[model samples]
Target: ILAKFKSKGSLNLHLWTNCDRKSMSPTTFKSQLYTHTGERPFACILCDRKFIQANLLTVHLRMHKMEKLYLCSTCGMSFYSSGALWVPSCNHTGEWPHLCKFCGKKYITSGKLAGYLRCHTGERPYSRLCCDKSFHTKSALNIHMRTHTGEKPFKCKCHKAFSERSNMKVHLRSHDKS
Candidate 1:
């Protein structure tokens, strides 16, 4: 199954057959089924995020609670999950595992490479249901959603809130000038 044909109404593909297990427990079978069927029964209480397993949902809830469970070895930055630490580690390791075929641009991860390719192809894959805005990456769409939710997570000591980190940084510059 190719990435481009994902939404093209299933190319009569039984590619999910590779994951089928006959001797596994019912719980294990259910998890494997959800991977192929896209069924997420475990939902977040705080946000729109859904998970196939309860433990993954628990890890996601930590994000809403601002729980720093994992710490970066290179930097003191904290994250709610161990998986989120990979992006920051790339800065310290200076490793480029993926490369773009269109351009000679180097990326830290395959996900970053996909985003760079989006820029080259001018494809806005992530879209907002609330508005007509579309974004090249899901992160950009997530940031745009803050505007509708009125969520200003980036806060300063003087009690100013900003939807975007760049906006908060600009505001902090004003504080330094005064």
Candidate 2:
């Protein structure tokens, strides 16, 4: 069953395995396959970092010259993405507007609420094709992929690299102490 065929007598095109033709076209479906395959075709010319999609590469490139349009009024912290600015803004306001329908748990952001819903539903949409490891969020899956890709995105002034940002932040403390 390599390819599903209609008996219309024409040669059928076999889609790549793990592609869902029902939801998306073959081209778009193949593009998303990069995530599971760890095929980062989109590269950041400045840093030589790669991404699975153009949009993700676009977002990453913004960090190099971040405009910081979304600012936290309370702390003066700024972000290129509005979603990134939401946490501090909600924390300062002490507002939990988004509520979970299943558990009635209050969350500051709808994204958090959606994540919480996944907990209740046990739905993990993002999965690693290599190990079958699944994650509720794509970012988490991407981070998990570093184990396989050996991609240490977090780098230090001394050229030391880390898989996790927090680990890199902690390593940076040693630099400060020196």
Candidate 3:
């Protein structure tokens, strides 16, 4: 069945055939074990994404719903998941598995690894250029850009233009005030 699919040039499609077992290789069985154990050996530092296996991380994403099990006593910081706390703690303790190529910076979480890359690139976007002026952060830049672009992706029933959807909602109340 796998041969048939390969012959048809459908390698990208994950088709579960009724004729035979779904797994094509022994590697897949190993991945199944990792998935069951939630043992994500592969991690991303740029984003809060991880997978039990490297192959899974290619498609799998960070589950935002995971419980925040760890807490910081010093800073009173809380995370949405245990992985978030785990990585940061590991980084602070010099337990990082991956090292950055550009800089000597090391990170336990792939998300933080990517963020560190931004520091090397110097594109952290502390300020954004719009209409020959700079504004702090992309949100502010987006709002300022609207003034020059005259594009309102967000709209209210009152037919007023807004730089952001949240601003549009706030502006809508003004119509009722009058």
Candidate 4:
């Protein structure tokens, strides 16, 4: 059937189906035809972005509208989607389900409990390739790497730069005195 479609001078059809000749439904064929014919019926009014499906356009419009429909009754926090509000709202009673076996400390998430376990086990998983120094967290090792690379990301109005934001704030104070 794909060979028949290809032989019928349907090169665009071959590209859309990715050479999959079998199991081509009428609805799938119609959608692929719309793609090749540049027929995007659903469009975002906020932006010029066009989508083939109405549901996709609806989801995209939420970003422009900034709709916070999902709300938490306890914390007074809002979320754009119901799924975003579900987890936090379920844990609203401030119950830490994940507990550390070593220290018996409770954590809201598994990732936080794993980080705490690393402290007791002396597990410094993140290591610097430049030096033999290791850190429990990737963020701590990243800050350490800036010292060796001398990469000053924080810059002042006077064209001077510092590796840390705290050091940059202190340098800005010197400018105020002058």
Predictions in order: lDDT: 0.76, 0.76, 0.56, 0.70
**TM-score for each candidate, following the candidate numbering:** 0.54, 0.64, 0.27, 0.41
Q: Give the TM-score of candidate 1.
A: 0.54
What TM-score number comes out for model 4? 0.41
lDDT of 4: 0.70
Global Cα RMSD, each model: 8.1, 6.2, 14.8, 13.6
Local lDDT at 2 for model 4? 26
Residues 25-144 of candidate 3 have per-residue lDDT tens digits of 546644655534446678765343445566445433332234444586645566654545655566456687768989677667666676667657766453434345653344556567
| Over 4 Å off, model 4 | 1-73, 77-91, 151-178
For model 2, the superposed segments whose C-alpha errors exceed 4 Å read 1-41, 52-59, 65-69, 101-105
The candidate that achieves the highest TM-score relative to the unseen native structure: 2
lDDT of 1 by residue, 1-178 (tens): 1111122354322223454344224465567677556589998876556788888999878866789889998899998888888888987888777888997888888887998799899999788668999999978987998889887766677888888889989999999999
lDDT tens digits, residue span 24-100, model 2 = 24555546566446688989987758876787777777786766677788999988777688788887878899989
Whose lDDT is higher: candidate 1's or candidate 3's? 1
Alpha carbon lDDT of residue 141, candidate 2?
Answer: 83
lDDT of 4 at 89: 69
lDDT of 4 at 152: 73
What lDDT, from 0 to 1, does candidate 1 have? 0.76
